[model samples]
Target chain A: MVFKGAEMVIESLRKEKVDTIFAYPGGAVIPIFDVLFDADDINVVLTRHEQAAVHAADAYARTTGKTGVCIVTSGPGATNTVTGLATANFDSVPLVCISGQVPRNMIGNDAFQEADTVGITRPVTKHNYIVTKRENLGKTLREAFHIASTGRPGPVVVDIPKDILYQPLEETYPEDVNLQGYTSPGKGHAGQLKRAVTAVNDAKKPLFFAGGGINVGDSSKIFRNIIEKTGIPVVTSLMGIGALETKNPLNLGMIGMHGTYAANLAVSECDLLFGIGVRFDDRVTMNLEKFAPLAKIIHLDIDPSAIARNVPVEIPIVGDAKIVLEELYPLLDKKDRPAWHKTIKEWKDEAICINAYEGFNAKEDDSSYLMPYQVISTVNRTFPDAIVTTEVGQNQMWTALFWNFKEPRTLITSGGLGTMGYGFPAAIGAAIACKDRRVVAIAGDGSFQMNLQELATAVKCRLPIVIVILNNGYLGMVRQWQQMFNGGRYSSTHLNDRIKADKEDKVSPDGSPDFVKLADAYGAEGCRVRSKSELEDALKKAAALTDVPIIIDCLIEPEANVWPMVSPGAGLDEMVFCIEKEEE
Target chain B: MNHVISLLVENNAGVLARISGLLSGRGYNVESFSSGPTLDPDITRITLVCRGDDTIIDQIKKQLNRLIEVIKVSDLTNKHTIDRQFALLKLLVQPGNRGEIIQLAEVFAAKVMDVGSDTMILELTGSEKKIEDLVQLLDGNIVEIARSGLVSIERGRKHAAVSQK
Candidate 1:
C-alpha cells in the first residue's frame, strides 16, 4: 500500500500498541498533526510546553511497562525536550521522542526553525536516527521502539525532516529485525553465577542492596526468594523501594544519605554487601571512602562497565538481574541468622523512637508558620503508597528526606539531572499510566511556575493528579544558599515581582497570583491551606477525591532550607543538621 | 590487557564516530583503529585495538553489539582465530635489477598493480608477519610502502554465532 510518511508513522504507532501520545504541535510538525486529526485510535495530549510533553511521556513509561512516545516540532520544541531526555537517560526510562525537523533541503543552511536535533540529543539518548528518506520511516520507527524498550531501556529520538514526512512511498514494514552486532545477553553466564553464589554463601552477615533494575528486570519474586532462603536483610536504593515489601522482616528500608537509620546502620556494619542491579550513585553512597566500610561487595549488573566503575567489587557478575538472581537462589544454603535480624529490628526501633517526626515537639505558641518537613511528613502519613513526583531544589530534597516510599516505581523524581518543573507533568503522566492509584506532585512555587501551564493539560486529560505546591514566596533553596554562604546577598532569588503582576500589565494591583483560582479556571479543584490544621485537612480531602486533579497551595516559611545536607565542598561526614540555637 | 577486535558493518555515515564516541564516553581506551570498504561495496570492515582488562573489553563488545550499523565483532585474541594484513611496497627498480625484482615478486605471488619508468608497486596480501618479512627483504631498495591493518576470521568452521552458542 502507498502511504505518506506521516500516515505510516501513525499506523506503525498503532501497530506497536501505543494508545496515548503526549505532544505539542508547531509549523514543522503540522503535517503530522493533520494526519493525527484523522487518527482515531491514538489519544494525543496537547501540553503547554514541549518539556512537559517529554516529561509526561517519561513518567508514563515509568508507570506502565510500555515505551512512552512524545511528538514535537523542531528548534525550540526539540531543545526543550533535552532536559526530559537527559532525565530519562539517567534513570533508564523507555521513551521514543519523534521530532519534526525542517525539510531536508532547508537543513544546515541556517534554515528557519532548523536545529540538529539528532546531534543535540546524542549524549542523552540510547540511540537516535534522522530519516533522510521517506521509505525508511517504518523500519526506523520499529527499530527506535525496539531499542528504547529493550535492555537497559532509555530514550531514543527519530528526527523526521518535514519534506520526508510529506513524501510518498510504497509502505513496506520489516516482519522481523535481525541485528547482527547487537546481542543483549538474555541469560546469566554459568561461570559468573557460580562465583556469585559462592561469595553469598560464604559471607555470614550479608545484605542485599537492590536498585531500579529489579523492577525493570521483573525480578522481585526471585529477589524475595533469595532473601527469604538466605535470611539476609535487604536495603534498597530510592528506585529500588518496591522490590520487596517494606514491612517484611527481611526488608530494610531504603539505604543512602537520607535513608532510614536502620538501613544506613546495616550498610555500615554489614560484613558482605550483595549489590544487585544498583549503580553506586553518589546519593546512595554519601562518602564512597566510608560507604560499606566493613563490607566485602559483590556487584551484579547487566551493564559490565557499571560493575567496577564506582565501588571496587570482590566478585563482579555481568548478566541480566532476573536471570542472575534465579541462578544464584538455588546455590545458597538454607540458614536463618536470627541474631542479625534482631539487631536490625533494634536499630529500626531506635530510629523510629528518636529521629521520627512524632518525636519532634514544635513550640505551639510561636505559630510562625508551617515548615516544609511538616507538610512532607503529613503527605507521607496520609498516602503511604501514592506515586510521588517532585521538582528540583528544596522541595525535591525535602521529599527525598521526608517521604517514605514503600515500593519500586512509586517514587518518580529526577535524581540525575534534577530538573525543575518536572513534577506536575510527570505526575500527570504517572496518573494516566496508573489510573487506579493517586499520583501526588510536590513542587516549590518557583519550580511550579516554570511549567504551571501543564495544569491545562492535566485538566483536559482528567488525570486526577494531586499537586502540592510548597509556596514559600521566594526561591527557597537559592535564597538559603545566599543567606548561608553568599554573605546574605540575595540576587535574583526573590519571586515577589515575578508572581505579583499579570503578564499584560506591569504594575497590577495584586502582584501574586491566586493559584487556587488558576486551578479552578483549568477545571480542576484547588484549595489554599495556611495553617497546619488546614494543610492536614486539605491533604485528606485531596486524597479522597476520585473525579479530577487537585492542587493545594501550601504557605510555608520563606527561608526554610533542607537540612542534613553536606555543604558542597565539605566532606560527606560533615553533614549540617538542623541549626542549633545558642544559649543566652 | 589489550584486545584486538575486527568488526564488519554496513557502510553508513557517522557509524565509526558513533562507535568511537560510545567507547570514549564510557572512559574506555582505544589505542589503534582503522576502517575501509571490504570486497562487498555495501560493507565496511573496522579493526579497533583497545587496552583494558577483561571487564572493559567485554563491555566494549556488548556496547558495540548494540549499535545498529555493526554486523559482527570478533576478538581475534582467541587462538582459533586466523588474522591477516596486506601491504603494497613501491620499489625503485634499477635497470640492472629489474629481472631479479620481478622474479622475487613472482616467488611471493605478489601482483604488480602499477608500473612506472623507475618504480614498481607490488601488492602483497598475507598475515602481518608475512608483510613484515616482505618489507624487511626490500627495505633498502623500497621507495615507499603502505600496509592495511589486520582483518581477522576464525580458523574453524564455526562462526561468531556458533562460537557464542
Candidate 2:
C-alpha cells in the first residue's frame, strides 16, 4: 500500500513496538503531528519544551531498558534537544530523536525554521541520517532504531525534511539492515576471558569496579553472582550505584571523589581492580597516576576503545559485559578471602557515617538547619522501593551516597553529563515507564527551577511523582567549591534572592518566586517544610496522592557540603573527610 | 611519532566530516588527510597521517574504528608499505635559473605540466622525503605548491579491506 512519509514514520514506530513518544510541535512538524493526532495507538506526551521531551524519553529508556523516542520541529526546537541528546550520548542511553527539518530543497537555503539538524547533532550522536527520499524513510527510521539500541547504545538523530513527509511511497520496511562496518561483539575472546579469570583467582585482594555498563548491558545479575561466587568485594561508580545492592557486605558504596571511605580505600589498596563495563573517567580516577596504583587491572567493556583508553589494563577483554561475564564465570575459581573482607569491613567502619546512616543535621551556634542529606535520606526511607531520580551537584551526590539502590536501573540520574534540570522531568518519565512504582525526584533549589515548567506536563499526565526540592537557596555544589577554594567568595553561585539582595544591598528578595506557589500555578500540589517532622509529613502526604504530583520544598542548610571530597587534583586516598575551620 | 592510518569507509555523505570532526573534536592532531572514491564506487579510502604517541595513536585508531562508516582502519606505520604523495609546484623560471630548476625536476622524476614566460608548474609524485628534498633544492624559485598528503598500500597480498570482500 502507498503510504505517506508521515504514516511510514508511525508504521516504523509500531514495528519497533513503540507505544509512546515525548514530543514538542512546531511549524515543520505539523504534518507529522496531524498524522499523530489520530494515531490512537501511540501515547503522545506534549512537553512544554523540546529539551524536557528528550530528557523524559531518556529517563523512560533508562528505566524500561527500551529505545526512547522523541520528535521535535526544526530550528530552535531541534536545537533545544542538544543538551538532552548530549546527556543521553554521554550516558550511552538508547534514544532515537526524530527532528523535523526544512524542506529538502531548502535545507541549506536558510529557509524559515531551517537548521542543519544532522550537522549540528553529528558529534553528539551515535549516528544520524537525513532522509531525502520517500522510499528511504522506512529503512532509515528502522536503521535509526537499530543503530541506537545496539552495541554501546546512544542517541541517534534522523532529520527528515518537512516536504519529504508529504510524499507518498510504497511501504516496505526492512526487517533488518546490515551495515558492513558495524558489528556488536557478543562473547569476549576466550583467551582474554581465561586470563581475566586467572587474574581474579590469583589476586589476594580483588575488587570488582563496576560502572553503568553493568546496568546498561543487563549484566548486574551476572556481576552480583560472580561477586557472590568468588566472595570478592565491589565498588561502583555513580552510574553503577544499583549494579549491586548497596547493603551487601561485598558492595562498598560508590567509589571516586565523594565515594564511601571504604570503597575508595579498598580501590587504593586492592591487588586486582576488575573494571567491567566501565570507562575509568577522570572523576573516578582522581589522580590517574595514583589511582589503583597497586592493582593489576583487567578491563572488560563492550566498546574496544574503552578498555585501554583511560587506564592501562593487564587483560583487556572486549565484549558485552553480560556475555563476557557469563563466559568468565565458568573459569572463575571460588575463594574465601577472609583477610580482604576483614580489611574492607574495617575501612567501612572507619567511615565517619556508617552505611545506612541518616544524614546529619547542620549545626551553627546552637541553631539547627535541615541538611540536604537529611532530606534525601528522609525520601529514601519513605519511598524505599521508589525509582529515584536526582538533579546534579550536591543533591545528586547526596542521593548517590545515602540512597540504598538495591537493584539495577532503580536510580536514574545524569551521572555522565551531570546535567542540572534532569531529575524532575526524568521522574515524569520513570512514572510513565513503570506505572506501578512511585517516582521521586530529589533536586536542589537551583536545578528544580531550571525545568520546573515540566511540572505542568507531569500534572497533566496525572503522574504521581513526588519532587523533593532541597531548597538550599544557593547553587550548593559550586558554592561549596567557591567557599573552599575561592576564599569564601560566594559569587554567581548564589540562587537565593534574599542572599543576593543582601550582597547587593539594594535589590529585593521579591524576585525569588515561592516554589510552592509555582507548583500551585502549574496545577500540582505544593508544600514547604522547615523542620524534620514537617518534611516527613509533607513526604507522607505527597506519597499518598495517586495521580497528582506534589512538590516538597525542604529548606535545607545553605552551607552543607558533600564531605569526604577527594579535592580535584588529589589522590582518592587523600580524601578530606571534613574541612577544618580557618581563622577568620 | 607520526602514524599513517589507512581506512576504508562507506562512501556516504558526512563520513569525511565525521572522521575529520572526530579528530578535531577529540583534540587528536591530524598532520594530513586525503580521501577519494575507491575501486568500488560505494567505498571510500582515506589516508590519514597523524602525530601522536603510542597511546594517542592507539586511541585514534580505535576511535576511527568506532565510527559506523569506517569499515577498516589499518595502521601502516610499522608495516612494509608503498607510501607516496602527489604535489604540484609552480616555480619561478628566470632565464638564469630555468635550466637548473628543470634539471632538478628531472632528477626527481617530476613532470613539467606547464611553462609560462616566467614560471613553470611541475607535477611530482614520490615519497615525502623525495618531494621535500626536491622542494629544498628548488627552495626560493618555487612560488606555490599543493600536495596531496600520503596514500599508502601494503607491500604484499594481505589486503586491509579483505573483510569487505
Candidate 3:
C-alpha cells in the first residue's frame, strides 16, 4: 500500500499513540486535515489561534506525560506558534508541531502563505526538519517524534511543503534511522554519583534541592521516598514544585526570587545542597555568588549543559534523574536531621502571612477591595485537587508563594519563559488531558486580556475550566517593581489609565471592559465580585459549574503586591518584605 | 590561560550554531574555532579555543558535552599534540624583485600557486611561527593574506581520530 505524505503524518501520530491533537486548519494544511476529518481514532481540537494550539498541546504534554502534537499552516500560522514553542522548549516539554509549507518549488518565490519554518524556528526548537520530497516524509516525521521525546525532551518542528503531500509512492520506512551522535547517558559516572551520595550521608544539614526534572524524569516517587528515608530538608525551585508533597516533613516550600522565607534561608545555611534536575536559573539562585555559600554542591541533571552552567558544583552527575536517584539511593545511609528541621521551622514561622491567616480581611478599611492572596488561598482550599495554572506576573508569583501543590505535574505555569498569555489555554488543555479532575487558571487582568480570545474555544468545546482573574487594575508585579525601585512613579504598569470624568485628580477606579461582560460575550458564565464575602461565594459558584467554562473576576486592591521579593540583583537572603503596611 | 576543547559531534544542521551559541551565551570568549568532518562523514571533529581559568574551562567542556548532538568533548589544551595552520599570501611582485620573492618562497617550502602580471600568490602550511616568519619576510610587498585557524591531533593515539578507527 502506497501512503501519501499526509498519510505518513497520521501514521507517525498513531505510532506514538497521540490521541489528542491541538491544531488550526489553514489553506496550506487542508489536505492533512481532510484525511483526519473522517478518522475515528484521533481527536483533534481546533483552537482559535495557532499560538493557543501550541500552548494547549504544551500543557497536554506536561500533564499527561505524553508527546503533545500540534499542526498549523505556513507563514503567520507557523510564526504565531513561536511563543508557545519557546515555552515548551524552556520547560523541556515534549511537543511535535507539523506546519504546512508552500509547494517545494514556490518556497523561495514568496508564494502565498510561504514561510521559512525551519530557519525561523531553529534556535527555539530541540530539532526541526524541512521535508522536501514525498519519499522522505515518513522517515523525517518518525525522526521528529524520536528526537522530541528523547532525553531532556523538547519541541520539534517538521515543515512539509505542499507538493510533498501527494505522490505515487512505493514505501520504505527504515527499520531504524541511524542517529549516530545522539545518545543520553542513562547511568551516571559511578565515581561521581558515589561521591555525591557520600556527601549527603556525611553532612548534618543536608538539603535536597529539586527542580522540574523530577516531573520530566518521572522520578518524583523515588525522590520523595529517598528524602523521607534520608531525613533531609527539601527546597524546590518554582518549576520544581510538586517534586515531592509540599506537606512532607522534609519539604520546605519553593526557594528563589519569591520563594518562602524558610526555603531560601535553609538553602543559605545548609551544609550539603544536592540539586537534582534543575538549572540554577537567576530566579532560583538570586545572586549566584552568594547562593548556597555554605553548601557543598552535588548536581545531578540529565542535561550536562545545566550541571555547572551557573554556580560551580563539587560533584557533577550527568544522567537521567530517575536512574541517578535510583543508583544514589542505595549508597545513602539514612539519618535523621533534627537540628536542620528546627532551624527551618523558625524561618517558616516568620514567612506566614498574617493577612491570609484564614479570617483576616482587607474589607475593614476599604469596603470595595479584596486581597489577591485571599482569592488564591481560597481556591486552593476549595478545590484542593485541582491542577492550577497561572499567567505571568502577580498571579503567578502569588500562586507560587501561597498555594500548596502536593503532587508532581499538578501546578502548570510558564516558569522559564514567563509567557503572559499562557494560563487559560493551558488550563483548558490540562482539563482535556485529565478529564476527571478540575483545572483552574488564576490570572491577572493584564495577562488574561492577552489570550482571552481563547475563551471562545474553551466554551465551544465545553472544557469546564474555571478561570479566576485577580482584577487588580494594574500589571501588579511591574507596578510593585516600579513602586519600590523607581521612586513610586507608576508608569505604564497601570491598566486603569482612563481619567475620571468628574474628579480632576483621580484616575477612574472602574476596571475596563468589565470581565463579566467579556465572559458573557464569549458565551461562558461570568461573575464579578468585590468584598471578601462575595469572593468565596463567586469562587464556589464557579467551581460548581460543570457544563461550561466559568470566569470569576475578583476586584482586588490595585496596590496589592507579591511580598518578600529578592530585588533583582540581591541575594535570596536579602528579600525585603513589604510588611510595613501603607496607610489606605 | 587558553584551553583547546575538542568535540566529536553529529554533522546535523544547527549543531555548530548550538555549540557556538552555548559558549557565547555563557560569556565565555572563543579565541579560535576549527571544524570539519572526521573519517566518518556522519561525524565532525570540532576544536574551539577558549580563555579562562580551570573552573571556566571545566564549565565550557561540560556545556559542549551537554549539546545533544555532541558525542564527546575533551580538553586538548594541555595534551601533547601536533598542530599546524595554513595560510595563503598574495603579494605584489615588482619586475625588479620577482626573483627575490621566488627565492624566499623556495626557502620556506611555500608553493607559488598563481602568478599575475604584477603579483604572485603563495600557499604555505606549517606551525603558526613559520607562517608568521614568512609573512614578516614578505612584508610591504604582500597585498592580502588568508590564514586558517589552528587544527591539532594528539602526538600519538591519545586523540579521538585513532580511537574512532
Candidate 4:
C-alpha cells in the first residue's frame, strides 16, 4: 500500500514501539502535526520551545532505556535542538530527532525560514540524513533508529523537506537495518579478565571507580554484588551516582572537582584503580599527572577510544560493562583489606567538617535569611523515594552532595555540557517516563530562566513536577570563583543589577516576573517562602499535588557557596574548604 | 613528528566535516588532507598529514576512529607506502621565458594543459618535493597555483579494510 512521507514516519515509529514523543510544530511540519492531532495511540506533548522538546526526549531515553524521540520544524526549531543534541552526544544517550525542512526545490535558495538543518547539526549528531525523495524514507528511518540505539548509543537527526512529507511512498517500514561499519562487542577477553583478577588479588589497597556507562550497560545490580563480595571501597564520577547505595559502607561519594575528601584521598593512595565504563573527564582528574599516580589502572569501556584517552592503564578491556562485570565476578577472589578500610574512614571523617552541608543547623543559623543547604537536604531527607533533576550551578552541586542518591537513575543533571537551563524540561520528561514517582526540578535563580517558559507545558500535561528555585540574587558560583581567584572583582556575575554598590544592605531588588505570579498565570500552584519554617510548610503542601506542578520560590543567602572545591587545575587533594573552615 | 593517517569512512555527507571539525577542535594542525571515493561505492578513503608527537597523533587516531562513519584508521608514518601529489600552475608566458619554463616542466614530467597568447597552465603530478622544485624553478613567472594535497596507498597487501569489530 502507498503512503505519504508523514504516514511513513508514523508507521515506522509504531514499528519501533515508541509510545510517546515530545514535539514542537511549525509551518514545515503542519502535515505531520495534522496526522498527530488524530492519532490517539501516540501521545504527543507539545513543549514551550524546541530546546525543551529535545531535552525532554533526552531525559526520557536516559532514564527509560528506550530511544527518546523528538520532532521539530525547520530553521529555528531545528537550530534550538543543537545544545540538547550535543548534551546527548557527550553522554551517549540515544535520541532520534526528526526535523522539518523547506520544500526540496527551495533548499539552498535561502527561502523564508530556510536554514541548512543538516549542515548546522552535522557535528553534534552521531549521524544525520536529508531526504530529498519519498521512495527512500522507510529505509532511512529504519537505519536511523538502528544507529541511534546500538553500539555506544547517541543522537541522530533526520531532515525531511516539506514537499517530501506529502508525497506518496511505495513501501512500508523495513524490518531490518544495514550498518556494515558498526559493531558492539559484548564479552571481555579471558586473558584480560584474568589479568584484572590477578591485579585485584595482588593489591592491598584497591578501589572501584565507576561512571554512567555502568548504568547504561544495565549492570548496577551486578556491580553492587561485585563490590559487596570483594569488599573494595567504591568511588564514582558525577555521572556514576547511585553506582552503589549511598548508605553502603564502601560507596565513597562522587569523586573529582566537587568530590568528597574520602573519594579523592582513596584514589590518591590506592594501589589498584578498577575503572568501569568511565572516561576520566578533566573535572574528575583535575591534575591528570597526580590522579591515581600510585595505582595500576584497569579500564573497561564499550567504546574502544575511551579505553586509554586520558590516563595510563595496565589492562584495558573493550566490552559491555554488564557482560564484563558478569564475567569478572566468577574469576574474582574474595579478600578483605582492613587496613585500607581504616584509612578511608579517616578521610571520610575529615571530609564532613569541610563540606558545607555538614555546617547547616537550620535552627541555629541566623533567622533573617534561608540557607540553600538547609532547603536542599530538607527535601532530600523528606522525599527519600523521589527522583531529582538539577540545573547547572550551585543548586546542582548542593543537590549532588546533600541528596544522598541511594538508587540508580534517581539523580539526573547535565554533567558534561553543564548547560544552565536543563533541569525543568528534563524533569518533565522523567515525570512522563515514571508516572508513579515524583520528579523534582531543583534550580537556582540564574539557571531557572534559561527555559522558564516550560512552566506552561507542565500545566498542560499536569506533570505534577515539584520545582524549587533557590533565589540567591546572584550567579552564586561565578561570584564565589571571582571572590577567590579574581581578587574579589564580582563583574557581570550579579543577576540583580539594581543593587547599588553604595547601599548599606547591598541586596538586589526582587527578581522580575516574581516566580510565584508567573506560575499562577499558567494555572499552576505557586508558593513563596522567606524563612526555614515556611520552606518546610511549602514542601508539605507541594508533595500532595496530583494535577499540577508546584513552584516554590525561597529567599536564600546570597553568599552561600559549595565547599570542598578543588581549584580548576589543582589535584584532587588540594580542596579549599569554604568559610566555615576559616571561622575555625 | 609528522604522521600520515589513513581512514576508511562511509561515503556520506558531512563525514568530512566531522573529521575536520574534531581535528580543529582538538588543536591538531592538519598539514595536508586528501579524500576521494574508493572502488566500493559506499566507502571513501581519507588521508591526513598532521603535525604532532606520538601522544597527539594517537589522540587524533582514537578520536577519529570513534566516529560512526569511520570504519578503519591506519597510521602510515612508519609503514612502507607510496604517495603522490598533483599541481596546476598558471604562469606568465613572456616570449623570452617560455623555453626556460618548458625545460623545467620537462624535467619534472609536467604536462602543458592550456596555452594562450600571454599565459600558460602547466600540470605536474609527482612527489611533493618534486612539485616544490618546479615551483621554485618558476618562482617569478607563476601567477596561480592549485595543488591537490598528498594522496597515498600502502606499498603491498596492507590494506585498511573495514574490520568487523
Q: Which one is best on DockQ?
A: 2
Per-residue alpha-carbon lDDT of candidate 1 for residues A1-584, written as tens digits (9 for 90 to 100):
88788888887888889999999998888989999998898889889999999999999988787999999999998999999999998888999999999999888988888898987888789888999888789988988898888878899999999988888888876656655545565677777678777777777778999888897777888988887888888998867867887668777777665566677778888888988888888878877887888888988887765677668898888788898888778789777777778899898777655454422334433355667877887887787879999898889877865776666677787876778888889998998888888899999988998889988888888787889999877788888778777877999887765333323323233344678888888898988775678887898788888868888888776677665555554433344554444588
**Measured by C-alpha RMSD in angstroms, how accurate is candidate 2?**
2.5
Candidate 2 CAPRI grade: high
* Per-residue lDDT of A66 in model 2: 99
Task: Kindly list the per-residue Cα lDDT of model 4 for residues B100-132, writing each as its tens digit.
Answer: 888888888899999888999999998889999
Per-residue lDDT for A211 in model 1?
87
Tens digits of lDDT, candidate 3, B1-165: 978777898887767877777777679988788899888898898878789987788778876665557787877787898777899999998889999999999999999999989999999999889999999999999989998878877887565752452
Ranking by TM-score: 2, 4, 3, 1
DockQ of candidate 1 compared with the true complex: 0.31
Q: Is candidate 1 or candidate 3 better by DockQ?
A: 3
Each candidate's fnat: 0.46, 0.75, 0.46, 0.50
- DockQ scores of all models, one per candidate: 0.31, 0.85, 0.49, 0.55
What local lDDT does model 4 show for residue A360? 59
Q: State each candidate's chain A TM-score.
A: 0.90, 0.96, 0.95, 0.96
Best-first order by lDDT: 2, 4, 3, 1
Q: Locate the minimum summed-lDDT window of 10 residues in model 3 chain A.
A: A498-507
**Which regions of candidate 2 are displaced past 4 Å?**
A352-367, A497-511, B162-165
Worst 10 residues of 2 chain A by lDDT: A358-367
Please tell me the TM-score of chain A for candidate 3.
Answer: 0.95
Interface RMSD of each: 2.8, 0.6, 2.6, 1.9
Q: Which residue pairs collide in model 2, if any?
A: none
Q: What is the C-alpha RMSD of each candidate to the true structure, in Å?
A: 5.5, 2.5, 3.1, 2.8
